[model samples]
Target: MPQSAQLTPEELVEVAQKISELLGGKVKFAVIGGAACSLVRVASDAEYRGTSDLDLVIQPNKSYNAEVISNWLVQKHPKIIRSVEQFGVRIPAIPIYRGKDEYLVEIEIFDVEAWPNRQQYNIADTASNPMTTLTFSPDQYSGSSGDWKIPVMHPVWLLREKILSQYEREGSVKERTDISDLQIMLQVVDPKSLVLSAHNHVTALQNLMAKRPDLINKLRRAIVCYPVFGD
Candidate 1:
């Protein structure tokens, strides 16, 4: 199911805060995707605002009780309906709809049976961004409003994910936003480092670009001004 309307930054923050309260200090969560960018105001343009869903990576404590958390969500927010979809492993998503607007939260769980060997790498160690990397630690990307704080993805990795997404999506028209997002990011972040980080995981990117030769050109153009080439 999809949402008819998107969530404002304020409303999105509210949802994340409630989720933070539920998870408390026990479960660790880091957000990725458009909502994460929006939270940090990465691209301060109209095109990059109002994301439809909040994409998060949740690494629950070994003692994480799914039923208890699920029950708490339903009781706290009756509009929050839960559903699980299997894309290799079960991905639990909660879509909260009120009146005419709807917001979705997508959680990616770590240490799963499907993914036998899970590696936890920090953005500072991997992506070569100097501004936030020096003091920022891994899996500690968070935002706050008053007393509540919620995690967000590191910008370096977020840019990598955006580039990876652009490579995966077909059609010049369909991938325009993804391309624009990458361009916007490159303007601020180090394009060479981002591309190098992406190349580190080249197997997946290479496969996707194999079918979309045109996308390679698009990626190249986005980083053309940078020191690195998409080759």
Candidate 2:
């Protein structure tokens, strides 16, 4: 028999925390990707499937020169197993191998004002819109890091991201993931929820729905309202 060591959700969150601290706590960004589901501990019930890398979207404190941000992110990443390249085009990535498996720790920094775009963001807490700071608790025993106990993006926000990605980076391999993601969002949603979700993504949704209104609309109204549960 053989034994193995893997980081838990808590450990992953700790990595995000450490990065935030090193960056002066200016990381008021939402967690994204499958890892986000683990850190926020929202989507998946299976924990063993979680560890691999940390994906972050940092809302910058000021105007972001993409070069500076990219450089800073690459340096902060844990280790470089190999240089990064995607479809002959280089991407920023580092590989980590554990036992028979190899993994990449990916860091993606996004500007707060620019990343989410207009028809996709809605986590607006009207608190004078000041630049936010960050902090995290590291628990060695649990193996979790970052904010892995919250819904990083509402179900709808994800739909919007998928929609935008589809158009912005069409024919790219990642588009397949975007399509799959949209279907998942459709599964978790219903009609009213769809509209509530679409209010921000109508531009994207309208086009998608025009093609499959029956399917999309069916989901749009499928969710049962809880307040009148007994009615």
TM-score of each: 0.57, 0.50
* The candidate that achieves the highest TM-score relative to the unseen native structure: 1
Instruction: Highest lDDT: give the candidate number.
Output: 1
Q: Kindly list the per-residue Cα lDDT of model 1 for residues 1-231, writing each as its tens digit.
A: 554347665566665655655666755556556766665552243344556555544443456544444444455555554545546544445666677655456544432222333233232233332222112211232353234456666555656666666666746653656655555554555444444433534643554456556656554543332224434
Clashes of each: 1, 22
Q: 1-231 in candidate 2: lDDT tens per residue? A: 122234555546555554444444434555565554344332332323354555555545464333345565566553532335545643354443456775555545444455545423223442212122223343443455543232255544454466656555567776655655666655554445422233434455454555445645443454332321211
Off by over 4 Å in 1: 1-4, 42-47, 65-148, 172-174, 187-231
TM-score (C-alpha, index-matched) for candidate 2: 0.50
Model 2 off-target regions past 4 Å?
1-24, 33-42, 45-55, 62-95, 100-102, 112-151, 167-175, 187-203, 210-214, 222-231
Model 2 RMSD in angstroms: 8.1
Please report, in order, the local distance difference test score of every candidate based on alpha carbons.
Answer: 0.51, 0.46
Error of 2 at 81 (Å): 10
In candidate 1, which residue pairs clash?
A: 141-152
